[model samples]
Target chain A: MRLLIEIEVRFGEFVLSVNESLTLDGVTALFGPSGSGKTTLLRCIAGLEPRAEGRIEADDQAWLDSKAGVSLPAHHRMAGMVFQQALLFPHLSVRKNLLYGWRRRGQRPGPDFSEVLDALRLAPLLEQRENELSGGEMQRVALGRVLLSAPRMLLLDEPLAAQDERRKAEILPYLKRTIREFQLPVVYVSHAVDEVMPMASRVLHMDSGRLQSSAAARVSGGTAFGAILLGATLQRQLDSRLAVFCVGNAEVIAFLDSDTPNAREVLLAVEPRDLVIATGKTDAPLNAGAMDCTVRSIGEDETSGNLVLELAAGSSSFRLEHSFARHSDTVLRVGQKIRVLLTQPARVASPIVQSGTGRDSA
Target chain B: MIRAVEVIELDSLWLTLRLASLSTAILMVLATPLAYWLATTKAGIKPIVEAVTALPLILPPTVLGFYLLILFSPSSAFGSLWVQVTGQTLSFSFTGILLASVVHSFPFAVQPMQTAFENNGRRPAEVAQSLGASPFDAFITVTVPMARRGFLTAAVLGFAHSVGEFGVILLVGGNIPGRTRVISIDIYTHVETLDYASAHFLSMLTLCFAMLVLSLVFIVNRRYPIRT
Candidate 1:
């Protein structure tokens, strides 16, 4: 589904203006610091913030169009939102809370309540009062409650922020399972980069209520290199050397010190600073591999005048950072003539091997 | 002599209970929204409305009663308007006494409810709305249940205060035995007639009832403490 959002809202002294479009077939994280309007943007998408002005369309359906005066109320939107606090009804039992939305919409049962109960490990707390449950348990129940609503899209605003590490770890697997099984588009708002990096397939970074350039990238795995390695075929040789036997249309060479007889696939990481950019052919005795690459874009880091070069090897693109003085010697611009020389082998590390597949990967 | 005095006291007790119960019921239904509005509204006129609701608390009972009497009299504009609508004069009637009791005891009903709503906070409602509940649904399902203690406090206070209302009832409805005269007015009449025995008995009953209501408020509030 295509999710397009261009909205501006004012809250007291803060004004939030966002213009973004993302495909919602997978999880997208709205990542930002606290009070950076991550939650406000999510609320706008969910139709909870009425003051927002602009157009929002999900799956080509116009959910909000300020000029056309077409704005759906929160209830009418086909989205489920989970808050930081569970905010479960004190008088209602866990079962009732989970079934609240089901009963409200009178929709046919989509996900089995019993299955969800087992997934969230809430079977033991079905009859428990809201106040009696622990914070982690409350969040689990809250997630179940929203899922039972059978929404087309899910909006979560820091669901795990209030929990401890143990609780977060406990519920993350179940959350992953739900996302995989449902395959619904999800917009997760969070300030924790670790959480977003793990769960989001697309990360949209926000700062001071504005979308930052280069903050939107498809996050497939822990590192950009790991994502490339997932689909690449590799050959490991002696002398702690590894070769990317095949990477789509390009080949890469790296060094691996580990010897595992059954190791067919391996993970790799490369620091941009470790890479050297060259405009001419150089034969050096350094223990590094060279690959032919073209410069895609060149930009400078705001804090440090270090040049960040976007380079493409075949269809795969990666980044390399060079110092300001080095970059100044070369005339670098978008579509500039350049070659990236890896002075050292890209460090190869064992794949962390996530428990599940890409389902949980936002 | 004691048996006859007990019977008369019971009659006044019954009148007091009837008036308090009816007035409390009316106030509860009416004040719930008022309290909710006071707790949540950002309307420019909220302060004015709140002040009007709390006016009886600061006004002397006699002064309040005098104004109510004038407001409910047959010759007054308000009274004539009520008569035209209901085909009956408001003053010196059971309905008039009920109106007077509600006005006098409004703050008792509203204050506790307002505090309860305010203490419960707006987070739950916002969360509920995000979870697909409409505003009214959220209020009834999430807010009302959470603020249960406040409702109880308001109900008890409104009932007890209405039972003790004297000046307003006296001025508006007068001592019309079994019709408009409540326990407080009954005690006044008994004392005015030099029946010290009857007056003393009725006053003690009123005191016990008030204490019971007050203790209930304390116990309920303590047991279900609000955590905002």
Candidate 2:
């Protein structure tokens, strides 16, 4: 539940310096880009990367402390790691692969064979060889194989990267189900924001190996397929198109992708380019997906001659980019009151996070 | 002359098989872990250990045989100790030739096994460990299975090299009939005595045996191709 990780590892010239403590009880997402050392952080936590020097404590247990010369090996650390590539033992059948850990653990704290077989729905694929399984099936078997060995923590390093979109969509729900059903703390590494929006209770934004804690992602009903989502309570549904909701005391209208949920609030992800900001208002109605906002900062786009505006609307903030070359009506400044608009209709997601973590709170 | 050559061939063939098989079996037991260590260890002395293991590959057979002859003689400390323990002279014995053959063929056995273990990579073992297996358990279960081809190559190479050995065994074993004179030495002795037919016969047998073993190795490698 509680983890304190402080480590400095050098891989040739690329030094990964991480000094942060985390509470990873329920699906904590390590959100970062490639080469940001997200995988390295996971490896260091699992005690697989020995080049890192520092102290790590999980649930009152000391997993690593370099100054004290106490470094537990990966096996003794009791953590299950899933790599990006499905690293199933190709020599063994799926059943044997699962049992490799079961036999090693032998009545340990982890789930038994029958339980794992049932939970992962691996009954049909037991006799199949690793090579025979599809990419998604192989990854599921790998996950089950790791889970069979009683582990104190779960570290998934972009487990869906190798899979196609359909495979990724297929496995993601199962992953969320596993974490919830088993109640295991997970440190998930991913570069995609939409991927972790529904499952991760807490989000840690990482860049260049530096970790910064973000808002609570607290997914209530396991939904992340939304293209554009915001934390809003369902004030009520007027028709299908016109629905009003409260985003931190600001009444806003949005176009929903599906039927309005019985639950109160819903969330989804939207692209930055999809959002448009108008410097001067021209009688655009509030029901047309336009909300009043204070302009925080405006910067020029050197690449495309477009102007980017950072706007804030009652506890929520989102960036909007516009072409100043075409609409150079007035000069924009910091802290200017303006109206922001969503040109396209956004699908409101079912599961919502309260207050939204790092939804441009800055 | 034909009858004499057949008799020598039968005796020398059996002796060669016994020596090669015994040395290879013992080396397998000893070298599995050693080669694993050599493959995985990040120690500062790894280069030195590697160089020592490879010495037999390039060292002159006569040079190695001369050193073994001195080391096994009763005048030397090792030879005296061996004599005291076994109640037999270390030099001019079957045990002496066995010892020399093992040293001469050490590189052939260890190199392939070591390379295989190295090529297997540390990821598999690390994966095993993360699955709650101890390091030793991971090595035996995961690493060994992955490196089986290397082991196969090592065993066949060691057996064949020991079977074809000549100079080292001769120097240490002194050409004792029915005891230390393996097939290669038998061929050498026959040629020395100008017994051309006997030499040719034994040489042909050994050549065919080596070629068969090597062919088997190639077939196994081609079939499995455990590189990935």
Candidate 3:
């Protein structure tokens, strides 16, 4: 689905203005911090924001055109949105809630009712009430309910943010599998880096109610400056607390403070501040191994006054921060070769990307 | 002779039940949309509308009856329209008392429903709409089902309040046996005639009935409390 949006919404003192054209196929992450207007943008696309005034077109359908006074109500639009909270109808049984949308899906052709039930593993909980289900189960049912709505596209507002790591881990696989099965374009909104890296094919950053940049240009995960390593597969657990992953051709070993996830494939995120770049080619003594990298670009961070160096290793690109006052001896240039020591572990997440797409690391 | 007295009592009791039932039904139908609007609207006139709806709660039933009596009089446009259509006055008639009862019980019917709609909030309805249900469809399928307890309470309270109405009925619907003479009017007649026996019997019945209605409300609330 191709979405063209140019909208402005004012909520008291906060103004959310967005103008972007996004072609969503798989999962496209709207990554930002809290109160950064990511959810507002999703609401605009869903036709839920009444104060939004501008043009929004999805797949050649004008969902909203303020100039022409053509604004479709939320129900008329084919975009299904899952709120941050799992807003399953409390009075409805699990089966009824799942079928609530399906019965009203109009003539849209999409997945079968039972197919969604089986995919989201909601068959056993059909007769159960909403209060009886766990948080993760509620979220899954919520997603399945929207899926049955036969929407042209899906808009998820941090669907997994309410759950803990363990529940998130348990539900991530089901979410990815179901999305892949349906092949519907999704605009997933989230603030967590690990959550976005695994699921998002492309990331759009937002801060202070404005779009910062595209993910290819720069990916700042909320408050942390980091780079997402997509399609990274977990090799194995070296021990209970340490695990290894393969990103492109490089092996990334991560320190697991929590229990290791059951999924074999995982994505890795590296914080630039956590990396230690050295001019020498010798293997530095660190718990995790280091790899050879060539500096792709060098820039200075305006606020923090730290030298931000962009490096490329194998087919993957990484950003590492080097303080000029601390590392004055090592002069860095755009084409200079360097070895980045992994003093800190790369953040690992369960993979949402399919196996074939993992090798397109660059 | 005893049969005649029993026949009169039964007619009054039956008339009271019919009046209460009709008033409660009409009130539900009329007040639901009003209450929903009061609960959801952000317009500047919301406060004014709310105050008008709640007037029946604070003002004495005599005051409202006086205004309604004038409104239903032949001198007024609505009253004349009713006369031209039905060829009968709205005073001292069952239909007149029914309309008066509905007006008196408006707050009893609308307050609970408005509170229910407020507690239910807009999220569920929004979710239903996002899933392709129209606004009205969402309200019926989602909002109404979730707030069923409030509707139950409102219905019971409205019915009980209408049944116990004496001041409004006496003002607008004068003593006319087998027509405007409800149970409350019957009890009032017995007292005025110094017939304590009939008055005590009918009064006790209404007391028991009122208690039953209130108990039903409390039980429903306890059984399935409204979700925050």
Candidate 2 on A173-241: residue-level lDDT in tens? 778778887878888877555676556655565656666554342221111111233456667666867
What RMSD does model 2 have? Answer: 7.1
Top-scoring candidate (lDDT): 3
Mind giving the per-residue lDDT tens digits that candidate 1 earns over A57-122? 877889999999999877767578888878887768898999887666666446778878777888
lDDT of 2 by residue, B81-145 (tens): 99999999879998888888888888888888999888878888888889878888888888888
What lDDT would each prediction earn against the true structure? Answer: 0.72, 0.75, 0.80
Query: Evaluated with TM-score, which candidate comes out highest?
Result: 3
Evaluate fnat for each of the predicted models and list the values in order: 0.56, 0.67, 0.85
* Candidate 2 vs 3: which has more lDDT: 3
In terms of lDDT, model 2 sits at: 0.75
Which is the better candidate, 1 or 3, if ranked by TM-score? Answer: 3
TM-score per candidate, in order?
0.74, 0.75, 0.79
